[model samples]
Target: MVSASSSTSSGVLDGFKLVRILDQDPKHKSANLLGEFASTANDGSASIDQAVLILEKTHFSEQFYRQLEDPNRAPTSDGERTIKAPKLDAEAAVLDGTERDAVFAAVSNLGQNDVYTWLLAWLQRSASDPGDADVKMTLIRPATQTHIDKYSAQRRVMVYETPEMYARKVQPWIASFPPSRIQWVYNILEHKKEADSILFEHPDTESGFIIVPDLKWDQKTTSSLYIQAIVHNRELTSLRDLTKDHIGMLQNIKDQASRVAFERYGLAGVQEGKPDGNVRCFLHYHPSYYHLHVHILAASFTSHPGAVVGQAHLLDDVMDLLRLGVDMKQRTLGYSLGTNSKLWSVLYPDGNPST
Candidate 1:
């Protein structure tokens, strides 16, 4: 008797049911498609829930040259534009007599030449950002971490919650987060994502931390060079988990993050007791994901997701609370959560909010 195993975990994207497009970034050529699928739990229970399909276009690479060698071949690029970028044209220079004749013929029609078309298109696109970029989608996956981050634009409810209320509503929700949800977080800490992009790193497993560019930031532009520092400790998830015991870890993250910002990015505020600078390191109570991380941003970035009243808490204030003998567990912590979140339902059982 032949029967399919009760297990429903399959790698194939056969029945990926698309719900809605959560968000899209034109400049980066990335998007978060929020959807769900029918599945079975480990114990073989049927279930359906949200899954983030992280779609990103692969950046231009050496494969682009392979297509040029064949001229008419396009394993990656859709079709030939004689002018993709100045660098590419220089690299794929006309080699021999036959090639030179073909090249001259292709560009003989000045009016219909794709070089003029590409250049005109490039000129208009360059107004947004100064650079040549050639990318076509090759990476798409069902995952977490960054998947939810792309859906940053959402209606958020400010939660003015006491410690007792947190224990009752928030703690259980935090507990429900499984380790499998944060494989991307693990990739960052383990140097899998950006081994070459580490701005600063402290190797100590417990109190140590690492700094890298935030997903939202375009790494090149200093105006948008928003970085993030994540502590090595996996146990610390959010502000709700902070306590007197974690003071040392908090302090180290603050100090290291600030020092690096001052030394490298030339932005400052809390490092040397200066009142003004570009870099501001802060934390979020209702972070997009479960992993504990510190947001370090340049002042020029005016519209980042978490830089608001309920979400952004500067590193200095967080550590100061511990230094001043405040019991974080008992103190009232106010933050925001998406109204669609389960925590919001618990906080506002009645569909209408009082405050």
Candidate 2:
């Protein structure tokens, strides 16, 4: 039970008591909390019975280095890792040897990452809930028809892309995304971000992949659990690049993904093991981003967008197609793309396609 009366000075959350956590996004430091509040019978005195409280960490401490010589407050001395501060002018930030003791005192402590994690814990912590203007109703789940209409969700159509078509259409269209649009995917594969979340990884460059939880999942419920296996090969982007020669790499990734799923998440129907758990793994076409990745979602997510016909191709089917001498590059591969997308425009220039 969590009470806000003691911690709140404005009395806005004076009677609110936390009941449970509905959802959370650890990367963003935000959570959707289900709570209950007391109410009175009086017309104007009555309060809401139940409320969903959304708490989010506003931002990270980016200017922690400036903590030093911040006149109003003395320099921090939490421990090493803090950045050394310098007085700045129009041209340069000067560090005077005369202030050695002060500079050393500040540099010798924690700041940057710590300010967002621990230092504030031992010092000062604050929360601000400004009400109506500050809160947006983002907790609505099981996206309804009205929500889809209000938001104008993009409806996609299936397009069968061939090698000749890829050269004339997809390749030229996707060129705009490399090293920029999907830079974060590279950061993950290179261990720059979410390195700790990698479940399994292959050291082989050609067949290598790392499995990580999909942000759509809460990482708690096994029924709706979702994960992704991102390929280590930076140059190989999608099914359009696959050939009979890449069968071994595809098989290796699938084998490892199955291994991790069987060992980690039970109720798994892995052929090598129990053959019991219902873990469905497939690869999306026109894949989420411009990188090669496999979507491994729980069997329960039948309504998943990727579950739609022609949207996702099963890993097993893909590998078998390769084994059967089907050339993915030359084969007419069907996939969904938004109507107004550049690829769509290129594929169906005049809104009429060739049979």
Number of the top TM-score candidate: 2
- For candidate 2, the TM-score is 0.56
User: What TM-score would each prediction reach against the true structure?
Assistant: 0.54, 0.56
Output the lDDT of residue 42, model 1: 98
Local accuracy by lDDT, each model: 0.64, 0.63
How big is the positional error of residue 78 in model 2, measured in Å on the Cα after superposition? 61
> Which residue pairs show collisions in model 2?
79-109, 267-277, 268-277, 269-277
List all candidate RMSDs to the true structure: 15.9, 20.8
TM-score of 1: 0.54
- Which pairs of residues collide in model 1? none
Q: What lDDT tens digits, residue by residue, belong to model 2 across residues 1-355?
A: 1122322222234455666665666775666666567778756687655555455553423344465437676334534556777445523433434422221111011122311211111112223422111121232222234433333435666677777888887787877665788989889988999999998888667778899988888777777768888988888888777778777877776666666666776536645456344567787777768788988877667866666768788877888888888877777777778776666787888875763
Per-residue accuracy of model 1 over 205-299 as CA lDDT, tens digit each: 87778988777876656666688988788988887667777778777766666566666765556445452454667888778788889898776
